[model samples]
Target: MTAPSRGGPAEAAPAPASAKPGSRMFASLAVRNYRYFFFGQFISNSGTWMQFVAQDWLVFHLTGSTFAVGVTTALQFLPVLLLGLFGGVVADRYPKRRILLTTQGAMGLFAAALAVLTLTDVVVVAHVYVFAFLLGLMNVFANPAIQTFVPEMVGPERVANAVSLGAVNFQSARLLGPAAAGPLIVVIGSGWAFALNALSYVAVIASLLAVRASELRPATPQRREKGQIRAGLRHVREHPELIRPIVLVGFVCTFGFNFPTLLSGFAYNVFDGGAKEFGFLTTAVGLGALAGALMSARRRSSRTVVLVGTAAAFGALEAVTALAPSVWLFGALMVLVGLLSVTFSTTANSLVQLHTDPAMRGRVMGLYMLVYTGGTPIGGPVVGWAVQHYGARAGILACGLVAVAAAAIVGLIALRAPRAGAVAGG
Candidate 1:
């Protein structure tokens, strides 16, 4: 199959090439390949979210320890910290579609293992820890491959729109998954939720098989060389636009995005709620994220001000949520927090992908995932410890304060360097 040319839309006639810049909200769907990818991810992400809720609940139930919950979260992301750079090298050297197929299958198998253990009534906290680490190993490769695959489906012209729409699909699943998981766990069982998640992988694998190979715009495969990882690091260090946003994300993600630890602590300890209430809390955040992602889709371009401003608002909202007097009030504030978080994350993701060179995109995204997710190993333990000793409220408050500080520090740096601002705005 012939890859799409890097030139004009005239080179590829399979997709609707007439989609103008004015109608970019769903512009990536004009390509048949992206349409398949979109629907596949929708179903798959929903299943993934269901598993997330079920796993958290199961761990808490088995241990009744908030620190155990944090350990689970940390184990799941540890591989990204260890192998993320190597994963990027593999993504740039191999076919992403093939890599996704392999990794998705491995993930499904892991989910099946968990379901069996739970159904047999023989599952323990140690089993959960082992499975989470294995899944993280798969993600070390899958994350970078998935991140860099967006451009191949829609080409560079619609990359920003494609990225935003991807978020919409993910957040939409986030909404559906928790909503269903709560009732399903109540009526059926947590094991069945894992079974359903395993089944959902079939949809994504089928979609991968159905995509037209000829429609893809694959990057030139990178040659094997020494110091490739260092080269990727140097690339980001030299590019102020990329480095600044990544630094901001590293702080917020490391200190702020410990929701699993925070929410689990809040539901069980603070709110004194059950599984159903925990599900509701997550669903509320998902709804807010969906709204934010839709708003981001309408934007023509991502800017520095939007990224920094939304992050600041998100931090303030999270801080206030820690002080809510009732579960309903806390849930309400969660909506605003979710909205701002997605807005900042989606904008930052697009900014990094759009500005970086195609050949180096995978490596850069590998580093992005490293910082965005790998921090959990460090932050989860700290947040979990705080929740266990102090209170859920205090743990969440610490998250908010750190986010606000990071945004402020990055904002001040940008102001001092006019050229960095220009790069971000561009």
Candidate 2:
């Protein structure tokens, strides 16, 4: 479990401890703990993406209806709405490494279950729904813990770099997973995709074990409140600056960027293509997202600037993408959309972590996810129905309009709030 002390596929040598501060994008990678996690997560995320692609394909094979695909996505995200706030409370109370160890293992088992069902030809829409829900529940906790863990491992000063690096890792998986899965699913079947994901957990678990506990910065110490969840909500409600971006992300996730509903329709109907085209579209997005993350990594300004601008731009880009004439053009536009999305996402993520107290990090991140992923449940059915009735292009246009409006409203509010405060002070 220990990070390999020397050069090994699994082992990550700690970066030289003595690198003077204010280095570059991968500076945090030099730190032993972060290096271990970075590489481990990189390996595991590839499998995760593969599973994601396979699951989507399996569900589509089972039902062929776009709404059914939306439902599977909905079921997977529903837990974030219901339990994400509470999951944060759990993350705050426990040793994050220990919590991750457990959750990651549970997720692996869930993947295995899906694999069993698929391989045995017993996989049904209902079975996919059940497994997706279980994984969603696990994610309500795992997502926040992983988000907060970066700051815990690398501290605040290097947090931007760490966040960028994490985004890069995620994008790489997004790129590599679907590209590989498209062929693998064709050759072996969806079950192998699920199986690969189950095995990927081993990398993360091993990295967690290898990490030195003493290296992790401690979470904040707070008196355990009787209703901690409510307190967290109250905190967010009272702090628009802290909560608004998360709300924006959720809005985008649900309305502007419900890919399962939006892009699936595009792939199946508008483009007249199948899994390969879909995978190509997602891979193109990953490429753009990787670009966005790299851009954010090099930024040296206030986070609010990066977040607000990128989000607005993303919305604009999505609107244009909705009108793309050809499938190739549509795929190309998606790359831009993906790039802007990651720029906004990574900046928002780093900001939330940077501003939060360690004790409340998990809870705060949980709220972020609740707003981000939870929106899917609330918006999926609506978007799905829209796609069914109106047409996929109209549905996509609507999503884009919603995103643009949210950004405009929120951005104006953010601007006005500061002026209002200044007046009150005067």
Candidate 3:
């Protein structure tokens, strides 16, 4: 599909050609528009990670309840479970740049508000829950805009590269955010983490402001229509390849992706540690994930076998990690868990985007994000219960077993379905 016409400037501007398809791992960075978006979002994403670590740490500290941490996480994703589809429709109908600005600015405000509350020592656990849910509401729109915007910034030929590199950006930030938050949490308070996150959004806003509209290969805006949401779902239902990964990811993630819940429990209970220890464990996962993302960037295709295999390995590793007798062993095992988990995620993301038609891209990605992200909330409290009663070790073991089962089930289904040819070029 061709990008929507930008008229005068577009006519004069050079074609938004990408680097030699899969020849380079960072090919998408060659595109000026994508570079601005990437580096800016990198800064913002690191801050988001900081908030995640601090928020959960604070909640765990406050209630001294594993279930409380789970509940807080569940609240954050509840909006995505409920209103995610409508966000897709909005993404299709509006300019993504505008949606991003509005969402980013609003998020910064929420972070600043949280910071003020925490710094003044007036904050309650309820305040964090409210902010997390509010942030999810923004993400419902921002995620679709961000996910679908990649192909526009760089052409279709560079989508896979862009996606992988984007994962690299995120995972690398994971290494930084938690490690930095560790010391920050000790020196002053968690309030400073929130404050930095609010400031970080400025980088994103400025990057968006600097983007050259004419350089963008924007999609044709979908007109407002009554049955659009329904139509989008039907589109996915009719496509087996799309539906398969979406379902598989939901299952694996629902049980296996409760990292914060599981890790926090381990830090507080099993490992008998504090914020710095929690940060160390989380950063270990990020270290492995960064490696996984970098390796994924060098490849060209997203295959079902790879996705299923990674999920299986990730689950097995999580089970082993749960049994670690020492913090050192747990951290070491977590790196493997992080690596395999990220591989599965990047594969699923690449497969969905590569297979969908541009017209339905936003809506389809919305559904994908709904399942991918929404699964965590449904599982968090349940997993927390296992940790609360059985032990943190039990929670991780349960997640591993479930992920393995899901992979086996999905693998059998994939064998019976029509052949899935790998998406090449991009």
Summarize candidate 3's per-residue lDDT along 1-426 as a digit string, tens digits: 344232210111122455453456787788899999999999999999889889988898888996687678778889999988888888889999999999999999999999999999999999998998899999999999999998889876667678889999998787788778878998989999999999999999999998999999887898998999898899888877788789889988888888877888899899899877887887888888888888788766677888888988988888878779988899999988888888888888877876776777788889999998987767877887898899999889989999998888888888898785366424
Name the best candidate (by lDDT): 3
TM-score per candidate: 0.88, 0.87, 0.89
How many Å off is the CA of 90 in candidate 1? 1.1
> Mind giving the per-residue lDDT tens digits that candidate 1 earns over 1-426?
233342211122222346444465777777898899899889989999899889988999999996687678778899999999999888888889999999999999999999999999999999999999999999999999998998888876566677888889998888789779988998888999999999999999999999999889888888998988898898888877788789989988887878867887788888999766676787778788888887777666666777788888888889889999888988888888888888888888877876677777789899999998898888878888898899999999989988999889888887787654422111
**Model 2 off-target regions past 4 Å?**
1-23, 62-67, 120-125, 221-223, 271-276, 419-426
Winner by TM-score between candidate 2 and candidate 1: 1
lDDT of 1 at 383: 82
- Which residues of candidate 1, in runs, are more than 4 Å off? 1-23, 60-67, 120-125, 264-277, 420-426
Q: Which clashing pairs does model 3 show? A: none
Against the reference, the lDDT scores of all candidates come to 0.83, 0.78, 0.84
RMSD in angstroms, all models? 4.2, 7.1, 4.7
Better of 2 and 3 by lDDT: 3
Candidates 1 and 3 compared by lDDT, better number: 3
| lDDT by residue (tens digit), candidate 2, 18-105 | 6433456567787799899998898889998888888888988989985677677778888888999988998888778988999999
Q: Which ten residues in a row have the lowest lDDT in candidate 3?
A: 6-15
